[model samples]
Target: MTGHQKTAFVTGASTGFGAAIARRFAADGARVVAAARRIDKLAALAEEFGPTVLPLQLDVRDRAAVAAAVDGLPAEFADVDVLVNNAGLAKGLSPAQQADLDDWDQMVDTNCKGLVYCARALLPGMVARGRGHVINLGSIAANYPYPGGNVYGATKAFVRQFSLNLRADLHGTGVRVTCVEPGLAGGTEFSVVRFQGDQDKADAVYSGVQPLTADDVAESVHWAAAQPAHVNINIIELTPVAQSFAPLRVHRDTD
Candidate 1:
């Protein structure tokens, strides 16, 4: 295959935004390497996208596993032109003083360190090729801190800044870095994971609100990826019309 048919590596592709992004890339005619911790779910995606979708078991928090998985990519998909770091979540809703240290550790490990691991493992090749794109999934919480988003928000802030810094570091090279921040995304595992599988709590997050869906965010990523090589979109924050910043919410009690 020609260099134009280069592959894309997407992390956290089991479901939600990650899965949607992977499928979108496949539909756009790029070979996609979809990685996630859930092998069964990845397998399902591979079945749907056919041979163009290569599903691999990966846990971003595991540094060695991340390196091994990227190193193990097939020759056809080894020369990646795009890398999407979308494997992250918020664990608990607690004040910084009352939050569990374990939850904070998990967030930092997966969101911050995991991104570094993937970038370190794959970026050298992109730098050498002098052409590539890196899209890091960020959150509105990165800018507007909420009562319960103490550490999760901080991690995303790191992602936002890191993308800019990465872009600076890659100056003169053809590689581009971008941060995609989404606010109030529904129909995904985000709130569900934040609520620790509490279906009622997860459902309440989008109650009576038209929140952004996984496809909305996926479409934004696709737009960024398809931009001309000379055009580099820095940061894009997408939110649902029904939702605003945390302090802007109006609550009503119906009797």
Candidate 2:
């Protein structure tokens, strides 16, 4: 889909969708700069892909660090034609009143503020060059709220709106923005993290059901970025065939 090669930067590239997307981009002849907090994992990915991938350790939640990483990009991977804002996480799944405040803060920091920092740092170059793609990872929770998805869902909604606003702001700049929202994705540490390392609990989230995989999400990102220069895919929402909207909850009282 990429013609004549391009430089792509993917955050949270240590595993899951981010890593998959980075690999796919490299296979398609794009130079990839993979960023994640896990240097070992990122190094493994870089080694696996040989010279096409450049691994850089980063935590998206750190604004100064994120800026430093981008500013320090090696010459070969300096011109990032595509930026995948994929470094996000979900915390405790308790109801709002019972939810952990730390969890809520973490979600907001990483998903909303972290995204803004990356976009702020990279957008000037994209807009000035008049060519770029920023693909933000969102969630189905942004579209349909579920109990326990409180802060996580809210953060994704911020991402969705942010993408739309970016489009308006970049009207004639030839820079593109998109929000990819996925539901019921498996083969990732998302649930494990959310459940605080309870493997069994994490496993149950996708048990007895077929769900989307990281590769599926990666493919969607690749497809959107692969579109013609004149084409812009605003938002793409995806879910596994086995998943659908749930009926609204209602409480009954007997006299």
Candidate 1 Cα outliers beyond 4 Å, as residue runs: 1-3, 246-255
Task: Report how far residue 168 has shifted in candidate 1, in Å.
Answer: 0.9
Cα lDDT of model 2 by residue, 74-134, tens digit: 8888888999999999999999999999999999999999899999989998888889999
TM-score of 1: 0.94
lDDT of each: 0.92, 0.93
User: For every model shown, what is its TM-score relative to the native structure?
Assistant: 0.94, 0.98
The superposed Cα distance between candidate 1 and the true structure at residue 150, in angstroms, equals 0.3
On lDDT, the candidate that comes out on top is: 2
At residue 72, give the lDDT of candidate 2: 96
Q: Could you give candidate 1's per-residue lDDT for residues 1-255 as a string of tens digits?
A: 325885889999999999999988998888999999997998877887799999888999999998998898898999999999999999999898999999999999999999999999999999999999999999999999878999999999999999999999999989999999999899899888888899999999889999999999999998998888999999999999988744466789998
Q: Kindly report which residue stretches of model 2 are placed more than 4 angstroms away from their true locations once superposed.
A: 1-3
For model 2, state the Cα shift of residue 133 in Å.
0.4
